[model samples]
Target: MQPFELVTVKDVPEAIRAQAASETAQQGATVRFIAGGTNLVDYMKLNVETPRQLVDINGLPLNLIEPLPNGGLRIGALARNSEVANNKLVQERYPVLSQALLAGASTQLRNMATTAGNLLQKTRCMYYRDIAYGCNKRQPGTGCSAIDGQNRMLAILGTSEKCIASNPSDQNVALVALEAEIHITGPKGERTVPISRFYLLPGNAPERETLLDPGDLVTAITLPPVPTGAKSLYLKLRDRASYEFALASAAIVVKRQGTRIDHVRIALGGVGAVPWRSLEAEAALHGKEATAANFRAAAEAALRKAHPQTQNGFKIELAKRCLTHALTQAVA
Candidate 1:
């Protein structure tokens, strides 16, 4: 890591002022906001991300987890992952989210990682992390080495000629399934963006990951109310049992009326460049009987557009099975 100036701010306005002043002094300077530093510090050690100025926003009043008037949940960006997962409201109302959070890193790391940091986490692509290799994400227009290199763990969906890195966040997959909204604060003011539209695909510019601007800071995320008696589950298929990224993961929320499905939401992880919401799969299962046959059909519909590479062709079938198992568990 390079030598940088660390400025701690007590409030949001002060943090914004520090970031704005730094940007004004040095045009095109990398000024990053640090909360838990679980991801940023690791990237800094590898020299993948070298910001000259670090604005610590841990002291800001953004750590509250509250219930909205509409029966929804409001999660502050600064709230730790463990804190959110262990909260009684989250564990009871949105068990899928809690399960996803628990499926992530170890307990120590989860206690240090923040909600916003988890959402903004980068890919685990080997080529992108190592500076020796050429990566479009790390260096634009340099070419992506993962295209023809070791890409067994890369994305199978939402891939372009430029890059094929997968999104590696379990919590993000659940958020996408729940149709959560991200609340962002910037120099201009505040705005809300849906999680589905927050992440961008690796079309031509793999460098730009999220819709967040230069000075934008995520404040909170809001999840709409889940239907009464709705059941949800998160299933992850990885190389190991603990402390591993998923090779194929599914988050399913389903509401059943006797044997028929009332409503369903599905999202996939570790298979796409962004957290993939499977609307096609949901359409196939809605109003249909919650049986093994319907689950198989929905799984097929979810992975119909998948385009696998040389070494990762097995992911297509694995993701389908994972989704099917999650749906079956949710309805059972």
Candidate 2:
């Protein structure tokens, strides 16, 4: 742990200005915004993150969870995970998201974790977390030890030779499936980015994880209303039943008419450097009969681009099965 200065800001602009003072948004960023501190604090304790100053953004009035005029949902960045999961509207309108939230960490963590905090959640790669080991994500160009080392939990999709760390957010996978939009306020004012574009693949510069800039502050997430007859489900496969990250997980949103699939959205977690939204799988299933055969086909299409490492080859099949089962249940 490092001795750092903690400052609490009273407003959004102040918070943004405080972080904008940082030199850069990359791995060695010195300024960081803290809310809930569930994930950030953990890494800080590990000394993987050594921010010289922490800007406390808990006082800002961004905690509202409201329904939009156009039948969508607007979730404030500061809203707690438990609140979003247990909200009546969320449970009824976006059950996949609620289920995904409940499937994460534990009751205590969900209680303390904020929505934006989870949106900006870091990877859980062993090498990245332990400063002793070389990790491209933690310090770019130092070399990715996981590429040829212990990588059972690393990524198989959206992977590069330089990095193979997997995204660990169950909530992010669901958001990608729902086609959610992220609202951010930065030095240049406000901007909206789709959840699909929020996370970046760990290319040569693995230190950069998101599209957010140095002073960019995520304000809220907006979810467009689902189709009339759409059904959604979130399925997670992990080593343990609780307090464990997913080994393979699926978030599926499907609209079926009789026995035929009308529309579908599929996003995978614990397999990609980012939460992977699979247009390939959705295209495979559209206009097809809602049967096990089509579901299996879609799963195969989803993982066709997977590039597995030595120890994590099982993930390709595991993710395929997870997606197939989720699709089967969603349209049933």
Q: Which is the leading candidate under TM-score? A: 2
C-alpha lDDT of all candidate models, in order: 0.91, 0.93
| Candidate 2: 10-residue stretch with minimal lDDT | 22-31
How do the residues 1-332 of candidate 2 rate in per-residue lDDT, one tens digit apiece? 99999999999999999999998765478999999999999999999988999999999999999999999999999999999999999999999999999999999999999999999899999999999998878887789899878999989999998899998999999999999999999999999999888888887787888999999999999999999989999999999999899999999989988889898999999998999999999999999999999999999999999999989999999999999999888877
| Tens digit per residue, CA lDDT, model 1, 60-145 | 99999999999999999999999999999999989999999999999999999999999999999999889999998888888999
lDDT of 2 at 64: 97
* Alpha-carbon RMSD of each model: 1.8, 0.8
Model 2's number of clashes is 0
lDDT at residue 95 of model 2 (Cα atoms): 98
Deviation in Å, model 2, residue 15 alpha carbon: 0.6
Models 1 onward score TM values of 0.97, 0.99
Candidate 2's displacement at residue 251, Å, is: 0.3
Worst 10-residue lDDT window for candidate 1 reads 20-29
lDDT of 2 at 293: 92
